[model samples]
Target: MNEKEALILKLIKEDPFISHFDLAAKADLPGDRVAGYISSLMKQGKIVGRAYVLPEQRQVLCVGGANIDRKIWSKGVLELGTSNPAESSKSCGGVARNIAENLGRLGSGVSVLTAVGEDHEGHWLMEYTRAFADVAPSEILKGHSTGTYTAVLDQEGEMTVALAEMSLYDSITPEFIDRKWSYFASSDFIMLDTNFPADVLNRIIERCRKENIQLCITPVSSPKAKKLPHDLLGVTWLIANKDEAEAISGIKIETEGDFFRAAETIIHKGVEKVVISRGDKGLIYFTEKGEAGVLIPPAISIIDVTGAGDSLVAGIIYAHLNRIQTEDACKIGMACSILTLQSIETVNPILNNQQLLETFKQNFK
Candidate 1:
């Protein structure tokens, strides 16, 4: 790496999602010349193409569900058990998939693993996701249908009920994880969602323990949250919503004190850190470093709440990679959640590192 290449690489290291134009401005070079340096970096294997994985920054594998999400929002007050006029939208979604996409959007080296059917939907899911996270480790199951989730929301965009057809996820077994062991072995961090079964989760958690890799686990919902083992000895972070938190901790959370108790319970379960999201009430977090607090998001109009939590996880991971403080990392996460709440899409198309930092500074400071 010569002087110019060294300079560009330094800028890239600082800003994972740095644009070519921004790089040119920072490097004091011609805009068109930035591409050549990027190309050279790619050729020299100093950085991975598109995702820009540098040797110093290890990759993360997000293991869990990947599927089609169909959302239906009622145009007016929803009536129970009756047909109501609604507007519907469809998009690529799933817990791990959304988190991986958000991480990719924020310029992290991330790969998503899941089971998709050998059908057009499966093909399109993999191809569309490739634009964000690496989907090469995902498998396509023959003679099986891809999983799906359908959510019904009220006019306020709050999900009233949801139905999930996620049987395909059963195919993502321990053997499947073994097949992708190389990815896990090379990763410095690994993220898992409860969409995987108990054995699969336990296997990966144990391997992460053996490898001494950092692990973050997100439970998909209240029911699936039970999939986690009683011994969470190797888990680094357990991020969950209030209901899911209640399920995991066996605590009925009706007040602020209950929330803290729940987090403490999970921490005692051997998770290094615990964060329980309280929706509009803000979030409560207890970190491994002994930083604890509640962060309430600044008021903003919410267009949709689909990917807000996933974006929060992405923001924390981004902050950790950048060496941000733990409390502020949660603040960045709160900022990311607020940004995602303003978007109708699952993952906000306009999200980047700069936007997230700006939002953090504006709202949190």
Candidate 2:
């Protein structure tokens, strides 16, 4: 919080969509100097949070994977042998889709740019999404089967073995993304996932960067996400877990120092900021100059942890876009995660601003 850094933050907070040149002038510093200060401020949690906070009525474009998830649950630590779950159910499970749907529930206009098969499952998924959010069907490539994920949960409701299918998104090429980029031209933010091909993700990130579009990305799965192209850094706000971070950056993170070193390694690779969610341990956020950490207060009870991460991403981005500081955004994310882990679905139980505030109040009190 040097004076220049504080000024730089103020300028960006007032208008996150402003050009760097304009921000530089407003902060009365050299363009590159202002850029450095802004980046530093973000790492320090002064100008921390999303790049844009749109009017509550604006639209948010979510471009990524959509899948149906089937999970089997048992009473105790369910072993993999001879498997019949006590109960089984299906729900939407893709990271991008869950975040988009939850954002819609939070009263933001949401549109999903993804591909789904023309099959029965895709048909049902389309119908379901249309009921809750505005879906850009043109973004969907119809031919391949809809993606799906299956998980086996123990009595503790923790996932054991899980399988993901996302080959359907292979059809989302640059041509497809270019055509649909305009749909997001009027959007407040554009969120994506690693389900897309590296070239396609790079193109999308380039477009967002060239247009000063706020871009967020959630690495869908650790093993599958190991292929993310390093060049797509700097253009996206990366959201991942501890394992995913290790997988993507090729570094192990067991302590805060390790997390710091790992984050620096990735940032030097071109990433602007890294947000890592460490399950029950909480979250760690890092940028070029600094980092912040938080712990998830113990949950009352765990029902299902399936959509918790998605909910957290949505909550943080939503809070940031609404003018909350980055640290507060993490708290908001933690709250959303807590609610989702206590519920069966991936979405938050609360609706509307009043309900959200109330939930925060009751929980903290």
Candidate 3:
């Protein structure tokens, strides 16, 4: 193929549904010239007709930690300083991985960008994340210990304390992101967790801004959340739990007024929208355009709250990609969290688009 034809093919591979106009713009060619090239390629059997084209799947790239989670569920009231009877289990869990899995289950084209060690745990995590998303071979690093998080859950399934060993993620440097930059450029949206190094996050933020890509973030936890940049310019969405919002914004969330103020503080930092997950009380949100409200989720029996926040992020992204209204998007996110809370696993395996819609109708309608 000629140079122009090769360039057109590359662009098409990156985005199968890219319009002729967009292709012309990117290729720096006249519209007629681009059309001629496409027609030529079609005649050569290098490009298929749109009639055979599948619906474009909106791709979301998630960049953050991918680790093994160890949960210790106490059978009864436990002492903090001493041993207690507990049921222990291990599963693949990380803020980014969980979000990717949830989005994959919801039928979004998802990809994960993170690092894992060369150990058994890393191999396991790589395979597990690949089950739900497309993971590039270079995304998983070598010669480091795979990150791990250990959580102690109370009898009510609420987390009491958790410890994370995720230094391996430090290897996800700006250079690493640059190596996989095409994924970011082609994605419909990008989700980041605060587990990333600050410099790496900043680099990604800058790139997304330059490309006009929508960027979303999940502040994994309070302490780690503090690692986020002070200025969140170009951030399309900031999804955080109450503690994470409080930590990042330094606003104590003791009342309804405080919740609004916290969301406002984040919006002032240049985040287009801020969503605060308030566990059982539901969600409170605010937008840069002065729209704000609370979404109270329907009550449900709790099993384990392990990955509720991650699932909530996935739900909102899913809704946004599908062009669901903002208010209804929050409702879908609430339903996702409710479904996750009822499952013992980190991500509810049975959760799908149909089930999420049914839950939303049953509760919100």
lDDT of every predicted structure (CA atoms): 0.86, 0.73, 0.86
Better of 1 and 3 by TM-score: 3
What is the alpha-carbon lDDT of model 1 when measured against the actual structure?
A: 0.86
Spell out the clash pairs found in candidate 2.
53-321, 75-155
For candidate 1, the TM-score is 0.84
Model 1 residue 87 CA deviation (Å) reads 0.9
Give TM per candidate. 0.84, 0.79, 0.85
Cα-based lDDT at residue 253, candidate 1: 99
- lDDT per residue as tens, model 2, 104-188: 7777778787788888778777778775577753344556888998887877888887888878777777887765554656567
**In candidate 3, which residue ranges exceed 4 Å CA deviation?**
1-58
Predicted candidate 3 versus true structure: per-residue lDDT over 15-125, tens digit per residue: 888888889999999999998888766544355556224223338989888899999999999787898899999999989989999999998899888888889998898
Count steric clashes of candidate 1.
Answer: 0
Ranking by TM-score: 3, 1, 2
